[model samples]
Target: MRRDDLYITVPSLFRCPISLDVMKSPVSLCTGVTYDRASIQRWLDSGNNTCPATMQVLQSKEFVPNRTLQRLIQIWSDSVARRQLDAESAAANLSVVPSQEQVKVLVKQLDNNCYSSLEKIVSFAKESEENREFLATMDGFLDTVFDFMRNADSDIKLIEQVVKILDLILSKVSEKKPLLESSCLSTILLVLQRGSLDSQIQSVRLLESIAAVGGESKLKLAEKEGLLTELVKSISKDKDPRLIEASLSCLIAITMPKRVKTKLIQFRTIPELKNLISEPNTSVSTIEKSLKLLETLSSCKEGKAEIWHDSVLLQAVVQKVLKVSSKTTEHAVTILWVVCYLFRDEKAQEAVVSSNGMTKFLLLMQSNCSPAVRQMSADLLKIFRVNSKSCLSSYDTKTTHIMPF
Candidate 1:
């Protein structure tokens, strides 16, 4: 095949399933599956014991180099490289790509708030992957955009655009210092509170990104001035799934801190999360997140009281255990275990048993759940059985113990 044609239509067999790129070196696993060496090595390094393409558990980590496939790929790659060089030479004469100096100038224009400069910079960054990487490497570029948002006063449109640009820039840059600043965080919270819906979505997305990078410190900053409360309220009120997802993500990030978990309970986040979970047409992810948050909140006394106080919510949680994904099942079961083991509230225990929670627990033990989940299910079932017998025998005079209704 011609080199240019190879670029246009490389054989599917030449591509690594994991990287979805033309393979440089092919290796065969014990499963007799071929994959790119680097991609499979990284996958194995990440502790994966299953074939990425076949989803079959690997019998061994050993990989045999496929020299024949490697040679074929090398020959094809050489031909394609030669054609790419010729094409690049031809395109170089027809086009004038922006220089690093020119991009720096656009970056300066962004700092000065030059007319249409933000739009131009955003356009340039989005023009190609190379441009995005170049912009990311520009010193102080992310900080300048962050400062623009922080200093934005009366210009809502300007703030919105800056946030939009920040979102794009964040996707390219891994730097976290600019995003962790107090002024930048306050600006993002303000946007979440007062900006338009689109801007609010962008701001929440930016907050999620910051939380991912900032870890515990950023989470502490997020809890300031009832920001976490506002996030829960947004999740409860926003009809947009995207916005709700972002808000939940931010909440999840901050709730990692124990103090923040207690603070979220103080914010009465459980009721709102319960409402969100009960909402019709809610996505599984939203429901899963709500349950996960509840799992965290339930670790505290206030959270347990709040969850048990609402029988409907307790029943809903029981129903969610085996009904959703395994992760969701884990979270739901953990919450139940916490409440049942720590508090040992008879009413709550009775509520769960009556809701067929016992049956669900048994089903989960037999189903595909994590060992921890099954163990919790067993513990809960044992507790429920003991509690039911205690309840029955405590009232009845007979020697026989009957299950509680």
Candidate 2:
């Protein structure tokens, strides 16, 4: 397609966001991107590509251009210009060609092809960091990114491409927090809002990301938006084991401090959790997850002692761990370790530091535990004996392991 033809066709194809017309020059801008070529380039030159809307930072390596299509566009423009001059001359002197409209459509198709090529090229440019030539380009690029993320579902192909790009960006830079805080994070949240199960699963992973790259602000915002709770419940409610495990892992990361960690364990005594802990279909990973959460709660100086204050809560946790058969070691080791640490009062100590704790461990050790669980159980017994002189001898050997967990 000739350059003139490209002008006709390209705009119709790319669906330029700014002008709501065909992309002419097609430049990404800061305030709003432009389809005019000169404007897009000027924006790039001015370092406006990183973010048009929010002015966030973006790496230039993100973009990669298609050179073959670039050459085709140049040739297409030359042909169209020559053809146009011929048509205008012929129409002035005689009847127009029967195929004039067809020619226009053909030209438009070429332009669409050219514009598609440029889109890939610019996307590459974003990835390759090739356009990081100036801060102005970065500014425009970021603006462009916000536009795409906000309209991610504009095209199915585009959605797949954008998700791919997001993965790359996340992998490339660990500190793209500002970009994330803008529409990118929101887009991911929207994935949760309307996406299928796979998308929902992917959405929960953003929490792990926020924990890694963001501080208090973004996470708090996400939490307040109910995304955090949504993720937690997704794990608890999902029938798919893989999705359940992912939610569990995300929850474990989120609850690392007293202010956060205590909430999940707070429901330990609740009727809901009591039922969950007793459900036969629960996976080992999920139970282990709860135990790890408890460990985090126990280790938090501010929240550790509160577990014992509510005897029902304490009983719920202990009873849950003791009832486990297949998922026993994980539950036993984690609960033993955490309970021993947080069981505060003399009665609590009698439970945590007591030999009965050792008995629980000893029973679990006799089960089909792996070396790690057995080792941990033995270690817990030794620690209990040393701290509170509680041996595993409180109950008769035959009946001890049989008591209500």
Candidate 3:
């Protein structure tokens, strides 16, 4: 467990071929093939008699412990643990403004134990804004980051660490846009798809920074394969609120392109957005963001058709009006107006009406919402009134009403 060994990549020999993860218990079958005991046992229990890597049918199933490889794995595991402790220690030792010499030592360690060094740097950066500004101005720090991005190919762990570091300080680094080559973008997309939750959030924030450059960089991000898909996928599932907010923020930042909106629709972003808006305990900011994006999506023809037909989604959008902030009400009203009032979709109008949406519109008009929102609410009320076969007088303007369908 020498200090230098901590910098080296985990030996391929130490990894189980079946799982490609580091083997905890190395064992060998009679065919002279080694495997992690658990992985091989699972294979054997599943009725496989052939060697997984070599594919030779096994004449014998008895296996013995590879104590030598086991010992090596233990040593490697211990060294990694020590490196993590050292990284935490190094990050803790830095002052309010880390001195140049201390920064230099950490930067130098990047060529060795990059995972640990990155942990140290990100830990320190997270401590305070002044520390982030200090690190951004520190010479050679950006160079190290660019080098990692350029060389990052299949090392997911390294890529995850580097993306987290970049997300923290890229905004403060002035020369950032020029340094973002296509490979760096590809690396970011990879992390967005497969990295841990923290890495995914960092990837989303980094994409936001790139999109903010405005022009070719933004266009390039919008066009990257799997970038938009992954972004949509992040919100399509129930995730940590922070990741959802970051993904939503990034989507809002990059959706200026019409095709981006279309692609988002193709990826089924609307229904997930409906789920978000419908969730009772969702934060006000998240609901606002969800409505804003949904409002943007409702502008296109397919978006209109999508919202026009899904009654439940329409109900969710209707529920947001006057139920959240004024901004949410505004976005909600605009979306409803486009699908129901402007386009004159009967089903869309009915969905809103059926969800007590008539009352929401009634309340929105009375509230001091934006003039446009009030106007739209007024218009929407007219649409419902004109189309209603139900008893409209049951909708009490002074209080709640049970709409008799």
Candidate 4:
């Protein structure tokens, strides 16, 4: 057992009051105190007339079998056992390192329906960076994977494995154009919409890789019917933070096109982003990406107008300032600066002031925030200070809060 498992808390009710351990055989004495059979038997044999737990004299020396408690304890123990087994199995799979001969054999045996061999190759690829590079360099590995992908349409299990393997080795593979083919795009779209969470994450990352190869390829990807919709839909679904981050990454890569940005807004990406960043359990990385995506959306006139009108979103953006990592702080500050400082939206400025955003700006000015951020901070502070008629500008500000130019 791992050291951590030693600290796993067993349910108190499942434990023997006398032994302080999970009851192997729970029995209740006449006093209605349940104890492990062995422990209570020893107590009774010691000529004790009282129950160890209750300190009450037994009406009868006989103990009744507690079948219900015993069964409950058994179920709890079995679940813990299964959980430990699954953890051990996963760890074992991660630690397995296959040799080059083993990888080559698996690649040779690969076919459209050969899920096991492909799964093994994927496992090997995931074992280490060295294994991925080695697989990428293999003579027939790419050819075999491509052939399998061609005939594996709608075979979600096969496609999930194939996509994962490809994603693992994609960077090492020199030529990425084949992934842009019609059949391959269809497979990627299918996985994005229907595959398991892991597969969906891989599919989005695959799209990110393809989009990185700019020019006509990026344009072609952006123009794929229903492609942008699915990517935006993934963000709105908010299924997993990993999926949200991956989808945001892909959208950031491909959304340089104005049409794509418009479509994303039409799909309600902004509202979804609002809900995501507002969530307390959201990871810092996801929050950073969410803010970055929001900043991207705010660059457009329509997007800026939409964000400016959502008071809750503006407040959420304000709350993120200096709350998480510096990257998130920067993104959050930039979004605020755009709507409040650049565009001079009164409602947004009031929202910021109401959310204690001025304090964040004051602190940011004196901190190690970047010059651009500092400048934006200065601009926001000026926006509030200069509006003498607004009630928010009445707060006391020390000279130190505003850096001298």
> What lDDT would each prediction earn against the true structure?
0.74, 0.49, 0.80, 0.81
- Model 3, 222-253: lDDT tens per residue? 77777887888788534667788999999988
Q: How close is candidate 4 to the true structure, as a TM-score?
A: 0.70
Tell me which residue pairs clash in candidate 4.
Answer: none
For all predicted structures, in order, the TM-scores are 0.67, 0.46, 0.69, 0.70
Off by over 4 Å in 4: 1-98, 152-154, 387-405
- Candidate 2 residue 69 Cα shift, in angstroms, is 57
Better of 3 and 4 by lDDT: 4
Top candidate (lDDT)? 4
Steric clash pairs (candidate 1): none
What C-alpha lDDT, on a 0 to 100 scale, does residue 152 get in candidate 4?
Answer: 36
Candidate numbers sorted by TM-score from highest down:
4, 3, 1, 2
C-alpha lDDT of candidate 3 relative to the true structure: 0.80
What would the TM-score be for candidate 1 when compared with the true structure?
Answer: 0.67
Q: Candidate 3's error at 139, in angstroms?
A: 3.4
lDDT by residue (1-405, candidate 2, tens digit) is: 333552465424344443454333344433342344533454567856464435556455133332333334445555665677666455433532223244334334433553453234334435344332321233344344446667644554344444444543454443455545545556665665556555566556655656665457434534545555566566553234566667667666666544565455454422233334544556666666655555555665444566555455455565654565545446545554555532425555455533345566768657676655555565556555544434443422232232112
Clash count (model 4, backbone only):
0
